[model samples]
Every structure is written in structure tokens, then in C-alpha cells.
Target: MIRGVRGATTIEKDEPEIIFSEITKLVQEIVTANNIQPEDISSVVISTTTDIKSAFPAKAVRSLEGWQYVPTMCTHEIDVPGALPMCMRVLMHVNTEVHQKDIQHIYLNNAVSLRPDLVK
Candidate 1:
């Protein structure tokens, strides 16, 4: 089955280094928690809030070891009044046997508040 693993994280600033670091952390946590191999991922879609423009998070994803061919795309999230800023979100589609209810969705940094019900 193909399962969608969701994740989100916040950065303190709009700097390239911070964006890269936090996004890398978020994806890594998602992979680790779900025991997914890079080859198992079909694609990854990342979106950032309007406030984030210093870097493309997809660059961080493609740089991962063994992930050179994993498809990835980046875009800006739909802006909403009072929504969280400096946030990066990821939806990773992977080939896995894990049931939907068993999949782990990672929310790190300030994004933990975005899905308080899902964080374990």
C-alpha cells in the first residue's frame, strides 16, 4: 500500500541554513519513525508559509544520501490570517505495508502545536 506521511516544522528565521537544517530534521524524523527507506519513497511535496523564502526545502530533501532520484516539489502554502509563520510542511508518499493508523506523522519545533492531537 502507498501511505502518505505528513510532517511540519517551524524555523526561527528565514535564513537558508535554518530552513535547510529544520527541514532536514523534519524529514529525517519522519523516515526514522516510520522505518522507511529512501528508495521506498515515491515522492515528497513540501510547502512553506509566505514568510519563508530564503531557500527551497526540496534542495535539502534531494541532498539526502540515496535520495538522489526521489521526486520532490516545493510550493508556498495557502496563507491564512493568524496562521503560523516560518512553517514548512511535507507530505511524503511512500510504498509501505504499514497501515494508515500506524504511520507516524512528524511535527517538530513550533509546528507541534499545529497538530497537537497527532503528536505522540
Candidate 2:
């Protein structure tokens, strides 16, 4: 079965280094929480708030060890007024037998507020 593992995180600034670091941390946690292998992931789609323009989050995912071939794309979230700023969200599609309700969804830093119901 294919499962979608969701995750989100926030960075304080738009600097490339910060974007890379936080995004890397977010994806890593998603995989760890879901017990997913890099090869098991079909694709990763990342959307960042408009305030984040320093880098593409896909770069950080592709740079991971054994993740070079994983397909990834980056885009901007809808620019809603008063929406969370400096946020990056990830939806990773993985081939796994885990049931939908059992799958883990991670939200870290300020992004934790984005989905409090999903946070455990």
C-alpha cells in the first residue's frame, strides 16, 4: 500500500543555511517516525510559505545520504494573509503496508501549531 507521510517545520529566516538545515531535519524525522526507507519513498513534495525564498527545500532532501535518486519538487504555499510565515511543509509518498491511521505525521518548531491535532 502507498501511504502519505506528512510533516512541517519552520525556520526563523530565509537564509539558505537555515532553510537547508530545518528542511533536512523535517524530512529526516518523517522517515524515522514512519520507519520508511529512502527507496520506499515514491516522491516528496515540499511547499514553503512565500516569505521563504532563499532556497529550494528539495536541495536539502536530495543531498541526504542514499537519497540522491528520490524525486522531489519545491513550490510556494498559497499566500494567505496572516498565515504562518517561514513555514515549510512536506508530503512524502511512500510504499508501505502501514495503515493510514497508524502513520505518523510530524510537525516541529513553530509549524507545530499548523496541525496540533496531528501532533502527539
Candidate 3:
């Protein structure tokens, strides 16, 4: 069956280096948490708040070893007043045998507020 893994993180700034580093950390955490291999991922969809425009988070995911073949896309999150800033989110579709209820969703840094219920 196909399952979706969700993750979110915040960057200190919109600089390319920061965006790259934070996204890399977020994706790595998700992969590690889920015990997912690159080949298991079908696609990764990433989005960032309006304040983040220095780089696309998907670019950082693509930089991961063995992830070049995974389908990925990036987009802008809806601008909402009072929303968290510098937030990057990812939805990874994976072909796996894991049950939906057992899938782990990661929320890191300031983005943890976005899903307090899912925080471990």
C-alpha cells in the first residue's frame, strides 16, 4: 500500500544555505524515523511559507544520495496571517507495507506548534 509521511521544520532565515541545511535535516529525520529507503519513496512534495524564497526545499531533498530518481515538486504555502514564518513542509509518498496509523509524522523546531498532537 501507499502511505504518506508528513514533516515540517522552520529555518532561521531565507538564505539558501540555511534553507538547504534545515530541509536536509528535516528529511533526514523523517527518513530515519520511518526507516525508509530512497527506493521506497514515490515522490516528495514540499512547500514553504511566503517568507521563504531563497531556495526550494525540494532542491535539498534532491541533493540526498540516491534520491535523484525520486519524483519531487516544490510550491508556496498559502499565506495566512499570524502563521509561523520560515516554515517548510514536506509530504512524502512512499510505497510501503506499514499501516497508516503507525506512520510517523515529524514536526521540528518552531513548526512543532503546527501539529502539537503529532509531536512525540
Candidate 4:
């Protein structure tokens, strides 16, 4: 079955290195939490808040070994009033046998407030 693993993290600044590091950390945590291998990932869709324009989060994912073959896309999130800044989110589509309700969703840093119920 196809399962979706969601994750979000906030960067300290809009610089490329900060964005890359935060995104990579977020994706790494999601993969580790779900026990998912890169080969099992069908696709990854990443979005950054409007304030983040320094780099594409998908580029960070591509830096991972074996992840270059995984289909990935990056886009900008809609700017909303009072929305968190410097935020990057990802939806990873993976072929897994795990039950939907059991899937782990990660939210880190200030982004954790976006999904208080999912934080652990």
C-alpha cells in the first residue's frame, strides 16, 4: 500500500546552508521514524513558506545517498497571516505495509506548534 509520511521543520535563517541543513535533518528524521529506505520512497513533495526563497528543499534530499533516484518536487507554501516563517514541509510517498494510523509524522522546532498533537 502507498503511505504518506509527513514532516516539517523551521530554519534559523533564509540562507541556503541553514535551509539545506534543516531540511536534510527533517527528512532524515522522517525516514528514521518510519524505518523507510530510500528505495521504498516513490516520491517526495516539499514546500517552503513564502519567506524562504534561498533554496529548494528537494535539493537537500538529493544530497542524500541513493535519494537521487527518488522523484522529488519543491514548491512554495501559500503566505498566510501569522503563519510560521522559514518553515519547510515534506510529504513522502512510500510503499509500505504499515497501517496508516501507525505512521509517524514529525514536526520539529517552531513547526512543532503547527501540529501540537503529532509532536512527541
* lDDT of each residue in 5-100, candidate 4, tens digit only: 999999888999998889899999999999999999999999999999978889889979989899999999999999998899999999999999
Question: Which segments of model 3 are wrong by more than 4 Å?
Answer: none
Residue 14, candidate 2: alpha-carbon lDDT: 91
Model 4 lDDT, full chain set: 0.93
- Looking at model 3, report the run of 10 residues with the lowest lDDT sum: 54-63
Q: Which candidate number has the best lDDT?
A: 1
Which stretches in model 2 have alpha-carbon errors above 4 Å?
A: none
**What's the CA RMSD for each of the models?**
0.5, 0.6, 0.7, 0.7
- Candidate 1 Cα misplacement greater than 4 A, ranges: none
Error of 1 at 32 (Å): 0.3
Clashes found in each candidate (C-alpha, N, C closer than 3 A): 0, 0, 0, 0
CA-lDDT, candidates in order: 0.96, 0.94, 0.93, 0.93
Scored by lDDT, model 1 comes in at 0.96
Model 4 residue pairs with clashes: none
